[model samples]
Target: MPVVFVARKGLTKLDEKFEADFWAKSLDNVVEVIGNPDCPQAADGLEVGRAYQFQEEQSFSVAKKGDDFAKCMEQLADMVGYHWRMAGADGPGPFRDLFRHPGQFGTIGPVTSAKLAAEFATWDECARAIGKRSFYAWFASMRRMFEYAKTDGGVWLQYE
Candidate 1:
């Protein structure tokens, strides 16, 4: 299985009918509805027969075979504030470990847009210890993640 990332927008009572149609006519085995355990706010109020509307949904694989994953890595490196270069195959890059094991970096969950924005307001001390470039890159990546999360209305991460 490949890691997948999904972007979703929460629906309100007005979209109940559309949510129903989505669940009844569009849901598939490959797409899992993000719920309580992983997204608390999504399941804040429990009710049976209720329809939940997601305004957006996008999936991306994170394995070597996935082009999006590679693109994201390249983009992340370029967007960082640091003037760091990706390490060659023989060397460990600043984000080599993160690229190899994305799940270890963080978990998916509900988060306020402001909170997400605040996360990257400061650079990581550890990354700074590695090098100024590394620190800048780390800061940039965090900002990027926050931006994504804000647009998606939640944190999303999946790994095989």
Candidate 2:
């Protein structure tokens, strides 16, 4: 199965009682918020006010194998002004590890508004990183996600 990065929004009105009840019935299928320690402002967990319900339309499916995926990731890192070599031990570098394990879901972020804004600010850098058609496709996918996050809210990576 391909690992997909998804962004969900527009369902931010669940009260605490509803949230608890929802989780009680669907904990296994519930998605959790993930945090990037490097981003101090990143949400540590799901915030009640900003919570969103998952929707199929929000998915960005990424292939788990082949050169297409690898090259795209390389370009994505570059576009985001993120240098793989400079990534700290706990940074996005772990995303590469997803390829090694197939069919497993790995969650990556409650990527806060600050982080999303920072990434959007680097749009030009990302565009310049697109050296090939394959890279463009990946960049486009990620770009859509980032754009949505700007208004809808934070983002998270669900890899499998």
Candidate 3:
């Protein structure tokens, strides 16, 4: 599955909604941590625009202590719960939509508007980020559908 990048900001209520949605989907092999379980920089929270990577599975965390899943989870929680507090409704173009769908709605590896602004030099980079998300969503949805298509090693076509 392609990496899914989700940004949470400006919507406290929606953060809860995303949590509910993920749990309701009953995804297995995933753990959700609400706060910074491990303090990396001896700071209460990480710098606002930095990106941290971690494993999503328990086994991975156990094998790689340096991976720092806790920090990633904390950042995720902050995005969903607290980032919104600092956001102004009209401060910038995409800040307000952190909780909702920014004009471009897609999911892919951990890229966010803030990240884009910090690293990207031109509009092309931004477009590529959005494209990555769309590609990931399409790839995942199709993979799931294909998995469901084959049952008991037989392709049965049930016609109405």
Better of 2 and 3 by TM-score: 2
lDDT of 1 by residue, 1-160 (tens): 4445544445233334334346556543222333433223332232323444445544533343455445445554554432223343234434432333333333333344334445445434533554546335534554555455554344346555
True-structure RMSD, every candidate: 10.5, 6.4, 17.7
**By how many angstroms RMSD does model 3 differ from the true structure?**
17.7
**Tens digits of per-residue lDDT for model 2 on 42-156?**
4433553233454332777755554556666566556545654455544563232222222132233334433444554456464655566655665566666656554444455
Off by over 4 Å in 2: 17-31, 36-40, 44-57, 64-70, 77-82, 88-130
Q: Which regions of candidate 1 deviate over 4 angstroms?
A: 1-4, 9-22, 27-52, 56-113, 124-129, 132-142
| TM-score against native, each model | 0.37, 0.55, 0.18
- Which scores better on lDDT, 1 or 2? 2
Query: What order do candidates take by lDDT, descending?
Result: 2, 1, 3
Model 2: lDDT to the true structure: 0.47
Per-residue lDDT of model 3, residues 98-142, tens digit only = 323221222211233333233222333333354555333333332
